[model samples]
Target: MECQVKANPQVKEVVWIHDGRPIHSFMATGNVEDSEKGVDSDLNQYQSVLNQRYRYDHHYQQQQGPNHHGSTIIMTNQSLVIQKVHRSHRGRYQCVALNDQVVPGCKANQKHQYGVSKNEQIRIRCEVDAEPTDDLTFRWTLNTSGTETAIEWPSFTIVNKTISIATYRPESSLDYGTLACSAQNKIGIQERPCVYSVVPAGRPDGVRGCAITNHSMNTLLIECLPGDDGGLRQHFNLEVYYGPNESRSSMKVLSEASAQSKSFSSSSSSSIVFDNQGVSAIQHHQQLRLHSNHSSSQPNFLVSSLTPGTTYTLNVYAANAKGRSQTVSLSAMTLASPEKHVARARDSETKLTFFFASEQEASNKSLYIRFLPY
Candidate 1:
């Protein structure tokens, strides 16, 4: 509260809310023209109960400085003249006439900020001095290249002190463009980026889909789901384990960016039952093989039947923008028989379907039918 309000001393009072509650009633009383003389005008002035009571209540007798009011003084101005002042004078002030009248309070001078961990995990927050105590808010945006460009750490907060906040990243924002979060108060605010650089992750943060099926006792056609952002990767390897022994015996398909189905076919014939209550089953073969860059429609094999009934483990790795990712391991056991299955033929392909074995193998999210050469 510094500038002297340009008032004809006509308005009765001004009101503002605080902590979900309204300020107590106030009014300025007495005459207005001789305000400098400390006398209220006959027009009737508004007054507010200062934190302290004026020692000399008889208008002309009360001291000009602060009074002993109920609330603590946040600021104090000792300057008698309104214009000849410095920053040190503003403090808890109370004006009492017959009614309460005043200008907007000092709540319009605060700000807030936020932060995040790896993977764009975030924590939004804000901070400032203090006014009448209100709330705050924040917002963010992205750039065309999919980079987070701007941010308003906290949205619109109506407060001045420290602001508390929490936010979550959209599970689907693979693009991760420029983002901004803005923290707003009554009339003032501050902002920051949700992320400084909207750097596209070299490796896709999302990718899923790879299950096993049975067409033959020795072949396992595993359909894999690839990522759209990352095309082909560099440096890939696979490990196959037969029974308790380790070996390499499956073909690798490097062209898959989304869903893929490759089979591990072997010449040996036997039978290897599945476990995990059919949730998953692995076939072990004596060998592992990588297919010769097949056509677009060919299945990517992890193991090509070097020996049937032998268990094996597959370790896969792909290149990413950040660098190289650790290999992912999958377990598989070659079938006991030689009935190797492949792709399916459908006149009306409803969903992505693969021909494995018996209709019982069909999945809810996918179709696994093992029948004639579709």
Candidate 2:
């Protein structure tokens, strides 16, 4: 935030006051004093507050104006620029000029707060009356730790009079709090604080390694490993698609054929198709009920009432308050019907080999019959 007091031939000194307290004082003779952040010199008795930082600059360059040369020259800058604004900047502000009897009006800007993502850059501004006095100066402060502290390098940088910007990165500091800027001179100070809050970054990457753990003639147990949750609590969704055992696209036709499975019901045997990519190719939807004791890295889900000797495509998703992650897929085939088993006896030894519908059916199972005579 920036505040300025224009200096006239008659004005001698300008003081900025905030909350009825004098913050800084500027003089037409090119002298500046900051009671809170200024460096102690032989001419000033105030101790330098190193933790409280404020900056002062004088604009001496000639600019086009109403003078005979079409330029307005100044002896002092009489301007205050806050490099960064925080929550502590809120308060009543008034600028007072001494000797010249011209008092600069001071009013605090509206108190406002902003929400930013991690590593986002934010800027807060303060504006003060800059009537003819040339003795006004600006100061900036931050109150992230409950106490007002001087904002410094690496986090804050000066933009211009009335504007200061700061960057907050999660890897660095965790403080996302208040910023303040004050306009002042020897007479008084006007200050206002702005609030700022930082939210965590976006949702995490998708889950990994979705595969089947166990399955029976009518049931299956699927497991997967989920990635980060974007710093939020997460849950897993297990989607199952069952059909006349057709292609991935055919599952949609199967779901359309069975309207009773419109929503997921524990008792429903029909599949429910979802619409995220091909993940909707499921015959049923089930939220994986996980115990709190279980780690989020690995989640397990159980599917029930599947047809004997049938194939199912499962898509799992990890979601949080922010959003859902990408889908991880698992294909499973149920065991053959008990009636399909045929027992054969050879020389008092028996061999068992289960038959499957196709090569794709064989790949979906964790166990294949071994040809060993027992």
Candidate No. with top lDDT: 2
Off by over 4 Å in 2: 1-199, 245-298, 342-374
User: 309-362, model 1: which lDDT tens digit per residue?
Assistant: 544454444444445444344555565433322222334356654565665665
Name the 10 consecutive residues with the lowest summed lDDT in model 1.
Answer: 53-62
Per-residue C-alpha lDDT of model 2 across residues 1-374, encoded as one tens digit per residue: 22354443454554454444545443222211233333323213211111122222222221122212222112233443332333343455544444333223334564245444556655544445533335665555555643466473245554444344554444334565555555555444543333344435456567776566677898887777778767555787766665454344444544454564456443454345333233434433343322112223456877777777666666677777667776655556677675544332333565668788999998897774567532
Global local distance difference test of model 2: 0.49
Q: C-alpha displacement of 149 in model 1, angstroms?
A: 13
lDDT of 1: 0.35
